[model samples]
Target: MNTDPRPSEHASPCDAAADWFVRLHSGTVSKADLRLFEQWRQADPEHDRQYRNVCRISGAAQHLSAQALRAILKQDAHPATPQQHRRLSRRAFGLGLVGACSSVLVMGVLHRQGLFDEPLETYHLQTRRGEHQELALPDGSILRANTDTLAIARLYEGRRTVELRRGEVFFSVARSTRSPFIIDAGSTEITVTGTRFNVSRTDSAVQVAVESGSVEVSGGRWWNRRTRRLAAGQAVTAYHDAAPEGIRTVDVTNIAAWQRGDIIFDDTPLALALEELNRYLPHPVHLDDTALRSHRISGIVRSGKPEAMLEMLPDFAPVSVHRQADGQIRILPR
Candidate 1:
């Protein structure tokens, strides 16, 4: 559905992947653009392999100079499993599991026969509004939980699982020959050996993006079950009932921009861009005129910074920003 020009049939995979990488990183991503990207990647296995190669080289080369990048990747490229007696809840257990917050604690489940196969290590990872948390897994993996995220990580002898109850999580999984890292997010599930990727879950859909290595994403509504493999630099969004569409090439760099406390928008509809910005703001933003929803805007604004984001409205559209005594932000047609 994307109108962008694509590579020729004879074009090399690197050329095609490089083109996709540029488009995705241009700062605006659309369902149609991603859909078309999926088609290209799914058309051939070589496409995916080459795309991953481009992402690895680009990410390491560009991001390696940053201190934050060094921390996330120094142990990333260096980058788990388990089996137990087979008796476990295999689910997050607690009344607060559905609450706004939960504590990180280990269950005192007793092991039989003093068998040292391995004990399950479970962690309740969460962050409040405008908050971010970074954690290190026992297997040397790193988890970056984004704003208002709630996920549970469980480690067994041959399997490692993270149940994403809500929010987004970026994983740098440690390589393991025997164990596979699994992520359960709503109806979606992702499996990998060792990879760096991002998983974002909402009530309706789940999104998966691979930064390095590859991942298998599977999930659907109760009526359908879909599975799709995503190579590094590729992403896919699965809805509740839709089938596995395909893999879309994405910007492996900006996918984790929240780590830098910023959000980028490029010619995105006002309504859609507001929806993403509201995720970081404690107070919701409102538009005084519903008709202005279709107005498109583009800019870089710090995450959760209402003033900086709203001030640019008039520059892009005939809208003026307003603030209410009740701490509400709104936009009025100029």
Candidate 2:
């Protein structure tokens, strides 16, 4: 139902893939763009590989400053000799840009930096509505729990496991080949040796998004186990009674913006955004107009501040917020 330009036949694969990446992130990706991307990927194996590499680089770059990014790009563009390459590599390693440019080499660099070699500790964590918490795991990994979430970590001789009883949690796992970190979210199981990712669970569905590194998502009934390998910028959703959806590329930067105390809605359905915002608000928000539920809205609202989110609704959509006598906020057509 949407239209977009296709990559030129003569363009370099990496350049074409980069263009597609920019277009997709522009917040207006059409089905036509997706089809064109698929065609480009199918036309050459290198296209798919380059696209994945670009995604990894972009994910890693999210943590870097503008000046650091410019320095890395400059070094990459004009490394004249072997010595220059070596110098650039060292600079990259020092700036943590090595992982963005090359994952294979960054593993050794990370080892030398002692990122994954640390002592372990067991922990149990939870947070109520309007609350957020950061936790350091036994293996030096980090966990950020969102509102109304419950999680338990158990580290044993052979394995490390976390049970996400409810709500959402983001993990920055430390590499441990001897004991892979596993998260159990209802009917879904996610296994990762080292990665940054987010997991959210509801009564009907479970969702997983990989920000960096990789994870194996496996779940379903015992008789029919299904699995998917998700790379950086990829996400998967599975329902209790349905097969897991295929991997989909997403804006990893926006997936868990709540970690920054903000929630972003990019043309998201009013009903869905309201549902998410309600998780952080003590007073529930209700919709009086069923028609307004499906209306699209786009904005960034401060997390845990329902009033701020409610006040901005009219700026983007044909809706108004009214505070009821019962202390609940109701949204209706203006």
lDDT of 1 by residue, 1-334 (tens): 3344465577678667755654454434467878888999999998887777555423212211133322221232221112332222232223212211111101111122111224378888999878899889999889999887999888988778788988888999999979888887755778899999988775556778888999998765422455799998888877655655577787788777778877776565677667666667777778757898778888888876746787777888888877789987887888
Task: Compute the lDDT of residue 52 as modeled in candidate 2.
Answer: 81
Q: For model 2, how does the per-residue alpha-carbon lDDT over 184-283 read when each residue is reduced to its tens digit?
A: 7766788999999998775556778899999998766533447899999998877664556788887989879888888777665687677777777777
How does each model score on TM-score?
0.56, 0.54
Between which residue pairs do clashes occur in model 1? Answer: 79-175, 81-157, 81-158, 82-156, 82-157, 82-158, 82-159, 83-157, 83-158, 221-240
| Residue 25 Cα positional deviation in candidate 2, in Å, after optimal superposition | 41
Instruction: Give the poorly placed runs of model 2, Cα more than 4 Å off.
Output: 1-122, 219-225, 267-271, 286-297, 314-323, 329-334
Q: RMSD in angstroms, all models?
A: 18.1, 17.4
Distance from true position, residue 90, model 1, in Å?
14
Regions more than 4 Å wrong, model 1: 1-119, 244-246, 266-272, 286-298, 304-307, 313-325, 328-334
